[model samples]
Target: MWLVLAFAVAGGLAQLVDGTLGMGFGVTSATVLLALGVAPATASAATHAAKLPTTLISGLSHWREGNIDVRILLRVALPGMVGGFLGAVVLTSISLEAAKGWMAGLLLFFGFVILLRFGFGFRLIPVPKNGERTRWLAPIGVLGGFVDATGGGGWGPVVTPSLMTVTRHEPRKVVGTVNAAEFAVAVSVSTGFVTGAAHQDIPWLPVLGLVLGGVCIAPIAARLAGRLPHAPMGTMVGGLVILVNLVTVVSLLGGLPGWLDAILIVAWLALVGRLAWRAWEKEKAGRLAVVGNPGVNA
Candidate 1:
């Protein structure tokens, strides 16, 4: 019971973060559950299933707000779904420890990318104005789908930034489109897992707890999203992704000196606290901006 409650709390927190930032629920929930002795396979599968409804709801909200780009979805999500199914099959056959190590490395790299963005502002990549850039969408979809299937949550980390670099859309629009695309990927992957690997014996209590907690608090996150500025919100979300990835990597590395772990933990906490404070201030300022400048729709 205590364990179930803990999982529920973690899920709620993850969902809150994801709802506001457009991603991370699966990664957070799966990482926590994996640490609590759930098998990696089961953890990934259960988290995928548990996050389905939440993603759908959040994606619909973003769509209604005019965030989704249906053209991109058509080009990207189809390949992503296929890739997710293939990735799941591969994950079932891999050794858990090896998968964890690889996932850790990927997460660490993602973190490094975020930190780079923080230290140096986003470096815009020049792409042909013509639709040739969309040619990359299929490959990105495959990679994002594979990562999400293997790591439990990587769609945003891999897909959103890539799309932003190539497409150069507004930050909020990018986030909303990513969330909308993720709904399709998550649904496809979760459906495949449920049908093909039902024998894995998922922890239903924890899954149910996560689903309920996530669903209940998701609206709050959406509200907060509307109240925040795009640039700062992107920065905050990117920073959190990096910090979380760093922690996951360090934990997976296992043999780091105790002092190093302490340092990493402290740094993560400080970074997160600072980002949260900045976000709060930005939200207040954004609300004021919206009221004062009626032209600013965001």
Candidate 2:
């Protein structure tokens, strides 16, 4: 009972972050589950399963907001589904111990990407002016789907940024299209896991907890999305993910010195805190400037 409640809370918190920032639910949830020693395949399966309802709801919201591009959605989603299914199958085929190290490493990589992107304000290549072909999106979708299924989450972090770099669409449209396509990826990944040999290992109870918690918080998250500061939230989530996966990676490498681990963690915390503070200050200053110059074009 206590365990289920704990999972519910985790799910709710993850959804809160993802809803506000438009990403992180799977990564955050997977980090927690993996830190608790869950198998990689099971964790991915559970996250994808839980995502079914949430992604559907998210897609609908974006559609209503006029954020989706139906053409982009179909193109990316079809390839994403194929890649997600294959990724799930490959992950399930691996032994748990081996899969753990790989998943941890992948999550760590993702954490760093997120940290660099939000904390350091790293920007992707500029989108060319209708010069890039949409066909290229297929490969991006394939990679994003594979990563998301194998690492427990990465579709938005991978697909959204990649699309923004090469496509001529508005940033909001790219975000919305990537999100809408995730529903298909989730379905395909879930199907793959259900049909996999290790399907029996899935933790249905925790999955139920995640689903219920995420569903309950979805509407609230949607409301908060426009209200919260994105950079701070993104940095916080990235830092947390990095810390969690760093421990896992260190353990897989036969453990780090306790003092070294402590030092690394402390340094990371300081850096993340500084970045988040700076982001908050920047946002506050921007708001103040906008208010002060009411007639100036923002």
Candidate 3:
């Protein structure tokens, strides 16, 4: 009972962050589930499935707000669908449990990426002209989808930053389009996992709990998308990624102390306080890198 409640809380928090920041639901939820002894395939499947509703609502909201670029959606979605399915099949064919050490490492690496990219005043290449065919979107979509499925969550983290910094599109628009595209990625990954090795592996109870929690915050998160101090949430979630995965890796080594779990709770609380108190200073950093900088692709 307590375990299921924990999963629900994690799922809700994960979606809240993803809804505002455009990533983290799958990464956060999958990490928790994996740490709880859920099989990797099952964790991936459940996380994607759980994401379906939240993404749908969040995407629709973004679209209504004119934050999505239809052309980019088509370009990314088509390839992303293919990559998501293939990735699911490929992962199901392998022994993900046996490879969890590598999986933990992968999540940890991305955790750092999120921290540095979003935390330390990171910027990237200019956005390509609207629909001018950078020729890079296709491959990136494919690769992002593949990684998303295999790792349980990489689409937003993998794709969002690249699109934001590389293309110089409006950060909000890039975020919305990536989120809209996630609908397709989530669907494809879920379907693939359902028919693949994890067909019977869905944790219905925990998934339902997560779904309920996520649904409660979907609308609120959508509204907060562009308005919130995303970096703080980004940092918070990244901290969770590192903290949780680090614990998982350690447990793999030996029995983890009960006190360490208590410390993690404290660390999380401290980060939240730090983020809230530093909001003004971080905002001065201009994390969004405003739309018209004269260096854009248009």
Best by TM-score: 2
**Best first by lDDT, ranked:** 2, 3, 1
RMSD to native for every prediction? 3.9, 2.4, 4.2
Model 2 per-residue lDDT tens digits across residues 22-117: 678889878888998888998998899889998887777767776678998998999999999999999999988889988898888888877777
> By summed lDDT, which 10 consecutive residues of candidate 2 come out lowest?
218-227
Off-target runs (Cα >4 Å) in candidate 2 are 124-126, 129-133, 168-171, 287-298
By TM-score, how accurate is candidate 1? 0.78
Q: Write the per-residue lDDT of candidate 3 for residues 61-102, one digit (tens) a residue.
A: 888877788888888888998999988887788876555766
- Model 1 is weakest, by summed lDDT over 10 consecutive residues, at 115-124
lDDT of 1 by residue, 1-298 (tens): 8766776787787777666655567666766665566666677788888878777777777777777788887777888888887777776777878766665555555545443443334443455566447778899899888888877777776777678667756665666777778778888777667666732688888888888788777666665654444445445555655665566666665657879878977887687667656655756676788899999964
Clashing pairs for predicted structure model 2, backbone only: none
lDDT of each: 0.69, 0.82, 0.78
* lDDT: the better of candidates 1 and 2: 2
The whole-model C-alpha lDDT of candidate 1 against the native structure comes to 0.69
